[model samples]
Target: MKRILLAALGAISLSACAQAPGGGQAPGATASAPVAKPTVAAAQAKAGTPDARAIEAVRVLNPKVKVERVGAAPMPGFREAIVAGQVVYVSDDGRYLFLPGSGGALFDVQAQKNLSEDAMNVVRKQLLQTIPRSERIVFAPTNPKYTVSVFTDVECGYCRKLHSDIAEYNRQGIAIEYLAFPRMGIGSDDYKKMVAVWCAPDRRKALTDAKNGRGPTNASCKTSVNQQYDVGRRAGLTGTPMILTAEGVEVGGYLPPAALRQALDKLAAEQAPVATAKPGA
Candidate 1:
């Protein structure tokens, strides 16, 4: 899952073209910026609607970038712009823009992308409701404080590390819901093994047994196992042990219970601050 997330983000970063102000002989625009300004009507339409404006702004800024769609973010006055494989953000007035960064260092572009993704988290939260709870392997508490969906693979070493500390996660008010995503796609031994575990009468025990190196007895049963795979795919997931928070935050790999708890708390506390206009009349 880590590889997939990194790869997807990388692809998006590569697709973000340099935004050059004005048309013709601008500082950054492949070879050069165009000489003409964006159409007046297009700018007005984009400005009136945050979503529409963000889309139009990207097109005007970089005609080479192929934008597929535009939508509202979790916060008001913010817009999410999707350009083919990449995603970006634009302010309501279409004045500010952000892109993802490259390399291990978090550049200006990466910081902007993080802010944008944070604002769009609600979209991911909505997807959780589409799947029924019964179909999931739930590690729920009587009075749950927090819930997280985890895409796990039986064979992954870090997954075992997470399972080993399952009690700690539970004690921290973190309820874990397991979803299958065989690192190796169907036809591999790992995939076949996970299927057997899902088919077992006692799902919890079957998973435990499989993780302990004992292959589950071959069995057949209707389950939402494949559905989980599809969900991962749609969410741009391509690997195992993908952890998703209820608030729509995604942590790609294994995290100690304490660290995970701390991260969640931080996310919960950081609400978007209201932008203030100038005080002078």
Candidate 2:
């Protein structure tokens, strides 16, 4: 049931940004207050280029899928298109549509995943900003290479293991921002426990101690726990130790600090597409 609700939200988020994929932007949508132009330019770029014929082709196959014109490629002559909230490249003629993923010759599988994140850059940035950094228990480095938002549960073994390795992860230049997501659901004991931690005088310390099996102060007040859980749900997070990379890599479970850094570096490299020389001679 949770999965179904999440899928529905995902669809709605995409449809809300009819011109943009995953609600990054809408057609002719402008801010009422003064905003930077770079933000505007990025929104326009990420919205992609719409191919009416290609969209028609997709609709002819599956009428349920939504299509949007995102943009062109780093390499010329190829217009990037998004179908059903996934990234794909289409020829200038709009006759050939290329679906990117693993197990295919035409598209790079890892690159496809990266492309998905690329298309969602604006959405991730906006979501990140919506949550105030001060509200999070931040484990940061002096010069952090990458930062991740982690949705965690106190009783989960993996979450405990992840907390134990905090020093190692920080040493590897990976900062962690913790969000509460009690697996027992809202209004449960676990949920109340999390609320107590957030309502504590020192949220960061309370979280650390709670993960370490220390008791938290019993307190109650308005908090971001509910809102954070909602965000986690929207991001498709289930269970504990769900991590969101600064570059929009979303994954469940725990990863060792070194492995986590390598994963992030790989994601970064894929996102930064370099021009490759074509064979003509």
Candidate 3:
């Protein structure tokens, strides 16, 4: 099942272009930041099984990397693997791996979607579902129209600005579920402050105060701040105030009350199904 769409990558010379899933390059293209090419010796080092060979072949392209799965890609003559959170295609022969797209951007023109991003979001949604509500500092109305998970830092100016307007956000029926992401990494002052914020009694208030310029005091307890950090990184977090809508689109940085509401509403409308009239009508 892994080999069917049989267009060779690393070259744009092929006459019959296979509609692609994704990959790194077209043949003879220069990689300014070239990935280390996979070696046949490395391929032969693997134990029996073609699937096993394919997996190792993909891995050696970016050695020691963790991938979601190595499976049959939509492209013929290639296999797709979610390596380091993006889609890359490997040749069935265990030799070449690339991202198939024009100007280094992978896409499906017929579908009008970035096939690479679409593939990554599948795993993103799966990871989002695994997050426990208990680990988050949540602010919501009795019933809410939408919920957004935010990866935030108490120290980021934008994050602080967003938190300052928390009440107005909640009033708009936007449930703000916060997962801690201290910008300075674990063990920095900001990170310790976040751990303290998570450990504090009345965590919601503590978080709000920290964001509102109140300093963190001594506190300690078992908490999910570290785990939340890991989750945020895996979900492709590059900075604080990153928000994920229910529909899986990433809303980076801060938005004011009305602006945030507008964004959320737009996303909801986009995901909503169209109404249909009855057959006889």
Give the root-mean-square deviation of each candidate in angstroms: 12.6, 13.9, 14.2
Q: Tell me the spans in candidate 3 whose CA falls farther than 4 Å from its real position.
A: 1-105
Listed in order, each prediction's TM-score against the native is 0.58, 0.57, 0.62
Question: What global local distance difference test value does model 3 have?
Answer: 0.71
Clashing residue pairs for model 2: 47-70, 48-69, 48-70, 48-71, 49-69, 49-70, 49-71, 50-69
The residue-level lDDT of candidate 3 at 109 comes to 28
Q: 1-281 in candidate 2: lDDT tens per residue?
A: 12321233234322333453465556789857754222112124422333444444444444555655445544456555565566556555444445544311132222222243445555665676678987787888899898899989888999999989999999999999998888888888888889999898887788889888784736689999898888777665656788887655574479988888888888788669798889993
Model with the higher TM-score, candidate 1 or 3 = 3
Error of 2 at 144 (Å): 0.7
Please list the C-alpha lDDT of all candidates, in the order they appear. Answer: 0.68, 0.67, 0.71
| Cα distance off (Å), candidate 3, residue 54 | 31
- Candidate 1 per-residue C-alpha lDDT over 152-193 given as tens digits, one digit per residue, 9 for 90 to 100: 889999888888788888888889898888788765778778
Whole-structure CA lDDT of model 2: 0.67
Question: Regarding TM-score, does 2 or 3 come out ahead?
Answer: 3
lDDT value for candidate 1?
A: 0.68
> TM-score of predicted model 1?
0.58
lDDT (10s digit) by residue, model 3, range 83-170: 5555566666655555644423343423334455556577667777777898899999888888998899988999998888888888
- 81, model 1: CA deviation in Å? 20
